[model samples]
Every structure is written in C-alpha cells, then in structure tokens.
Target: MPLYFYSTREPYGEFSNFALYGVKIDGEWWPTTEHYFQAQKFEDAAYRRKIRDAHSPKLAADLGRSRRVPLRPNWESVKDDVMRACVLKKFETHSDLRELLLSTGDEEIVENAPGDYYWGIGKDGSGKNMLGKILEEVRAKLKNAAC
Candidate 1:
C-alpha cells in the first residue's frame, strides 16, 4: 500500500516538509524543508531570509504564499528541482530520517494534501503529487548509494 503523509503529527510525518528536520544548504541553515522551499519562490535575498528566519514552517509558508513579492520568473519551471534538492539534502543531513525513509522498502509515497493539487493528491486524488514522486526518487537514490 502507498504511504500517505501530510500533517506533521501523523504517521510517517517526517516525510512532510513541515516536520522539524533542518537542512543546511549553501552554507545557511533552514529550519525545515518547508522554509527553504517556500523561500525559494522569491528573488529577493532579504525576503528569502525573512522566510528562512520565520518562527515556524507555517509562517514561512504564509510568507511564501504571499504575492506581494513577485516570484522568480522561472519559479514555475524550477520548483520541482528546488524541492528535489531540499528533500535530498534533508535526508542526507539526517541519518535517522534516511533510515526511516529507506525502511519503507519501496512503497509508494503520497503527499495527501487535500488543497494542493500540484504537489499533493487533491481532495479527489487527481493531483499530480510531485512531492511524493520526488520522495520516491530520493529514496531510490539513497538505496543505491548504500550499496
């Protein structure tokens, strides 16, 4: 059966970007993958830092969802790559998370966000689920690297 994940409080919660795993990328520490992913939507360095330093992932998400700061022109095309890098780095930085992800043994991963049709399975299950697909890709990479 597929592994369904969404809320940070649920089973397999670590798989959610909102989970408390921090990742260091480009010499800076992000509080969570959600912060980093959200911050990447903008081109302003200061705005990005604001999102990065936000007290919580929910706040960072709120900042990211704001259209006050225009998004990078290529955000649409580069978002998946950004998420992939963040997820990979998060798992790489945390050994316990790596093991937990690998222990799933190839079960399909799904981000069960009812309102996010792009990165999750929407209410009707017709969403693209890009985040889940990225997690599976990262899982495969980690499995191969253990060889």
Candidate 2:
C-alpha cells in the first residue's frame, strides 16, 4: 500500500491555509500554507483535492479539519503530540487508495481507511507492532525450515 501524507488544519479551529509538512504517495513531501497548497514545493494538492472532492457522493458529513501532530500544548484540547487513531481497511493497494479518494472523497476515504498511531511511549512501552510481529514469525518459520 502506498502511504500518503495529507495536510489539514494543525488543530481544529485554526486557519485553513498554513505552511505545514505533508507526505505524498511516492514518498514525497507536501507542504501547505493556509488554505492553498505551497505550489513552489509540490502542487499535487490540486490532484488530491480533485480526487477528494469527487468522493462527495457517498459522503455523510461536511469536510472536517485534518489531523496531524499537535503544535500547541493545550491541556484541555491538545494533550499529546502524537494522536492515536485506528483505521478500521488497514490493507489497500495504491490503486485502492486512489479509487477510494475518487469514489468517496477525503472524509469518506479516511473514514473507511484503516490506520492508527501512538502518543508518547518508552522502550518498554514498545509492544507488538503488526509488521514487526509478521517479520518475526516469518524469520522463525524460516529458521525452523532450515533446521
């Protein structure tokens, strides 16, 4: 699956257009300033916007503020720098993501997409990661086969 980074408002109730870092499908970086995307940097925003917009047909709610690491330390509103969310199609190919964007818009795409993140945690806190467990199991199986 291709990982994409999208820029939305840093925090909810903030300016729409702001210069912030984002990620692209091809491991590219995207930055935005206020409501518009930083063109001099990477103008794929137009393409993304178009794709996201096209998904409005099955959309349930209006576009909401995008999410990213917390900038401010608002104890009431913002608690942690990393927000943990669960993307309930955790596995989808690049074409799947594109289809989702075009068919359901950004909101719906995100809604149906599967993902999650963790806040502040230490070494001991580093529990089982999905990919990590898979790799470990594969390694063990290979060792057993060799034996």
Candidate 3:
C-alpha cells in the first residue's frame, strides 16, 4: 500500500482525500509540506545559498518562490542525510510528522506529483520515486533510533 499526501486542502489526484497539512496525527495537526521542505534546506545550506545567490535576481526570486534548490549531482546518495537532518529538527518539535511517518507501517509514502520526476512517482508510476524511497529509509532510521 502507498501512503499519500498533498500540500493543499484539496488533495491532488489519488490523494484527493488524504490531504497532508491539516490532518491530525498523534492528536496534533500535521506539519505543512513547506515545513519539511524548509527543514530539508538546512541539509545543504552552503550549496543551496550559493546557487540562489549566484543566480540573477529574477532567477533567484523564481527559485525562492518555487522553493526548488539546485542540488548536487549525487543527490540520491545524500538524500538520506537530508531527510535525517529534517527528521532531527522536526521529530520532537513536530510530533505529527514523526507519528505520521511511523504510522505508515512500512508502506511507501509518495508525493504523487504528476510532473515531478525527481521527487514524485509520476502519474504513470514510471519515475524514479526517489522521495518515496527516502521517506521509507528515514522512517526506518527513526524506528531503529527509537529502539
């Protein structure tokens, strides 16, 4: 089974009823997608800032608005580290994130963005599914740490 989420109130596609942000987990509202995204940003501050700063003002603004960072080519290898950084910051402060992840019970959690080949399993389910894989790994790490 695949766990699903969408940032907005009206969930997208198959997640249409599984909205992420406002859902309650562990008696608390779940953190927004931006919360996770912002936390992940700290994982590679220098690189993210360098790219944003080096770009033209318009591009920089666009990047900020899009919240999309230019990552290292070996991002897949470092993705777990990024997720770990996010989990460390949010696990205690945002219990909802932690509890929700734990509740997945070994199922893959997919972001399900139709066009996001890197972070999502595409509509046809042909994409790399990197983000889902990272989430599972992070969940396992957290579970082990709790042991």
All candidates: TM-score: 0.99, 0.18, 0.54
Q: What is the per-residue lDDT of model 1 for residues 1-147, given as tens digits with 9 covering 90 to 100? A: 999999999998999999999999988999999999999999999999999999999999999999999999999999999999999999999999999999999899999999999999999999999999999999999999999
Task: Estimate, for each residue in 1-118, the C-alpha lDDT of model 2 and write its tens digit.
Answer: 2222222322211111221222242343223221112121223455445323433311201222222322223433432211111111111222332233333222211111123222
Sorted on TM-score, best first, the list reads: 1, 3, 2
RMSD, model 2, all Cα superposed? Answer: 17.4
Weakest ten-residue segment in model 1 by summed lDDT = 7-16
Model 1 alpha-carbon miss at residue 95, Å:
0.7
Model 3 Cα lDDT, one tens digit per residue, 1-147: 777654444332222212233322224332332333332333466544543343233343244334355444665576556544443444444466677677778787787768767667677877776666766777787789889
| lDDT of every predicted structure (CA atoms) | 0.97, 0.25, 0.51
Better of 1 and 3 by TM-score: 1
Count residue pairs with overlapping backbones in model 1: 0
Cα deviation of 121, candidate 1, in Å: 0.3
Candidate 3: where are CA atoms >4 Å away? 10-61, 64-80
Pairs of residues clashing in candidate 2: 16-34, 17-34, 17-35, 18-33, 18-34, 55-104, 55-105, 85-116, 87-114, 87-115
Of the two candidates 2 and 3, the one with more favorable TM-score, higher being better, is 3
- Worst 10-residue lDDT window, candidate 2: 81-90
Best prediction by lDDT: 1
